[model samples]
Target chain A: MTDPPDRRPGGRTARVRAQVLDAVRAELAEGGHEGLTVEGVATRAGVHRTTVYRRWRDVGGLLADLISAAGEIDWQPPDTGSLRGDLTALNEEILESLTVRPSFAVALMAASFHSEQAARAQTRLWEDRYAQCEVVVARAAGRGELPPGDTDARGLLIAATAPLYHASVLMRADPDPRLPARAAAAAVLAAAAGAFSAGGGTA
Target chain B: MTDPPDRRPGGRTARVRAQVLDAVRAELAEGGHEGLTVEGVATRAGVHRTTVYRRWRDVGGLLADLISAAGEIDWQPPDTGSLRGDLTALNEEILESLTVRPSFAVALMAASFHSEQAARAQTRLWEDRYAQCEVVVARAAGRGELPPGDTDARGLLIAATAPLYHASVLMRADPDPRLPARAAAAAVLAAAAGAFSAGGGTA
Candidate 1:
């Protein structure tokens, strides 16, 4: 079967998709979710409005595609020698993404709250990222850094990283230089104590 | 001096404000941020559009006032005998708020991302809640549950509660019933190890 014109990679379809998604990010960063509109994005992308309407449908579709595009980036979890180091490196990367000016990450997050399509796409991206990071726990266990038995990598990772989001996104607090390491250290201590051991009721 | 009519408690101004803010929450819960509009809120509140316009000016203004009203609520941190218990209680409350159907808390949080005024109001509310929760850490220190030093109550609290928000909000994961106590236990263990001590760089 022949591939559709829009489905061909490195073709005009791919170019339009890239242009539209870039415009979506630009609009979100500059004006936030409130100002993002199909017409505005189409104008910014130098694409026809009817083309955007037909392909993307609305702002929700644009947001969903933007999040899906993020998933396509070649990203990997930090692989420092120790779990503590790895988690800290991971956190630093997160901090950088969240704190960058006109942060595309933050804009995407805000967009997710406003769009069901975006929210579902974000959830898939998060699940994929967490699955990828499980190797960090596996490596730590192999090195005997964690207690014997299965550790809840999901729980551990959440504990290690949630503070950054809480402080920056929810509380809107000024970024503290030491927080990434401190939070990672705390999670490490807790994990070593088996707080995140699977099926364990509590520490 | 006599209070201005609008400034008097229990007067028409206060009633209108209450009605309008309640309407805002209802609209946000039902329609998310996209469905929120000054006209919708005013109509839902049974107030004249001019009255809402004169007072709230826009959807952002309505959202800000709604968040400010949340701060007016008389609330206290749980005083369970142990720090772990107290934190668990706090986490449970947080979980309930986040997981409730048509959750006003979640809606308000989503609204904050779209409006600068609402964001500032949410930041203030978070600061106040954190300040109130400091007593939990203080009580723990008094009982020798925490290390002998200035504990970073804010940091500890963030760690304990962040997992719930991360799982439920960001990941869109199903609520884990044991998470509140499990997370509290992890934070307690970390705190006892001096991970949260203000001057301690890392555990």
Candidate 2:
């Protein structure tokens, strides 16, 4: 089947999608999920309501598309020659993203809680983000810095992020400047002790 | 000022408070935060709206009281003599609570995201829960199961719960049957290595 020109990468269709998604973010920031509307996003994005409805159908659909689009962004894992450095850098990046737009982060999480589709999107988002960490672990193993066997990268990554999320999201505590380093240190310490390896404690 | 008989613990006032809070949970489970109504809750509790309003004032007020009431319930730490056993018991408790009423858990979390009052309540809830874990750590340290001197009970408790929360809450993944054991093992392994002591990696 021949591809439509507007549907190609970086085409008009893609631009419209990006514009609409950006508008959705703005709406969420201004009024939260409850106040967001298809009409509002359409107007903010300078797109027709019909188009928004045709593409997204509703707020849940828009959220799913927004999450998927966010996952599509290019993300590269840090390679600082050591497992500790790379993990620290990764955590710092997460800390920055979360702290930079905490309300947005909270809104996204809140949306995921109420809607099944949004929850699925969040799962996909986490899976994709975890893939980046896997690469970092793979590189560390290649450099002989990590154990040369099957490793549970998921446990290490979750351990690194969970404390930060607990403090930031659940507790609503002010961001601790040392949290990134502490998280990375803990994860590295645990991983070094084989806690995150296959059949290990964290496994 | 002396306390009135009705205002004392296990009295009529306390009974009313418990009834109202229980109704609130039922409302949240059935309709979520958006659909929860003060009138509905009052009716469900077989109390007048005036009584609910006099006590709670509004839904936010009800949520705050509900969260506090939940915290006030007797929650003793499992004194299993071993840090590993205690942590496993704690995680098991969390697993049972979350799994038994998944919708209620999600509703509570979602409410915290939108309302500052709810967020504060959630923070208080965590603080209260962590206190129970702190006692477990203190007892373990006394028994020489954990390191001497000051320990970071918060880190160990958070580490034990974070992965489970990440999987069950954020990713909406089904609760892993082995998660309680794995979480305890990881925390115990790390804590044994001083990762949860003063000046440890997680500190």
Candidate 3:
């Protein structure tokens, strides 16, 4: 039988990988993804160049890993007993994640734009996030809080959050404190009116 | 009097500038905005390098002018009688513009992200676009087609289009042909429900 690679939680390899990722975050925080380099990350992590190259391959590889790691965080989905409450909770979480760590968020966005691999990772992350949102909607439907039809959960979620993304990401505007709640309310009202139903909304 | 910079329609200066901008659009269409160069624009436009440099200053300057020139086009705002029709018309225009000349659209978007000067131009463009949308809502309200008390036209418009931008721009996904109509209906329903009214929603 072939030998297994290190799978221990606190092994040397895990520690090294953690250090490298931390360095990558630091570099992204210092600037944007404009001029990030593997050598720079390696130097910042205090790891050898060859080690960094052999492991990460390039900046795109590092960014893809970073995105995948972000998906791996043990983030709990919102379950606040109502669609409005659940949606508000989800939007607040997104707002906090995007604003509290601006550099990381911007870097992740830039990588998604600049690299195909990172874009795939971003799509996967979005799919996972949408799945969580679906649970909230499905539960609401079960409770008769929703209209008696198949509401497009993913569409509602995107509609709820897209304005926030436009303001912060494209227009470079400051995040409005009331935006998350407003966005959630808008989506909820529309959904309750059957605007998100497959046969109703897309006029 | 100091010599007047050629302000005459179809004057030598105007023609040269048009040629340069045409070349810029062609180049952007061919290769995107990643490595667009002034010299390349000059050569393609059959203009001298010094003339291009003196007039446009740099790529950012060229892009700024390009954006301003775009604003100068004879693009009419949506004039449909109903808010839903008007918003759908607006979104159709946006979708068509973004998809029809992808290189030009991507370059403009990239310029908005890459340069502060271009960002200002982009903001102005948005303001202009929003003002046009405001007219559609104002007219609807005037005709008693809308429920009253400050409908937040800009907010509604952002809600209507942000999903389309998310689908086409950030996510790198195929353009969803049904998105524009869906977005318009969602915004109209939300607006009618008073979700976009400052005092009505965000509860």
Clashing pairs in 2: none
Q: Tell me the tens digit of each residue's lDDT in model 3 across A20-103.
A: 999888888887776689999999998888888998899888898888888888877799998888888888877777778645
CA lDDT scores, all candidates in order? 0.87, 0.80, 0.80
**Model 1 C-alpha lDDT per residue in residues B30-115, reported as the tens digit of each score:** 88767888889889999889989998888888888888888889999999899999999999999999999987778878878878
Model 1 TM-score?
0.92
The fraction of correct interface contacts reproduced by each prediction comes to 0.78, 0.63, 0.63
Worst 10 residues of 3 chain B by lDDT: B1-10
Q: TM-score for each prediction?
A: 0.92, 0.91, 0.91
- Predicted structure 2: lDDT: 0.80
Off by over 4 Å in 1: A1-9, A201-203, B1-9, B201-203
Chain B, per-candidate TM-score: 0.93, 0.87, 0.91
- Alpha-carbon deviation at A58 in model 1, angstroms: 1.9
Model 1 Cα shift for residue A98 (angstroms): 0.5
Query: DockQ for each of the predicted structures, in order?
Result: 0.71, 0.60, 0.66
Off by over 4 Å in 3: A1-10, B1-10
RMSD of 2: 4.0
Clashing pairs in 1: none
Number of the top candidate by TM-score? 1
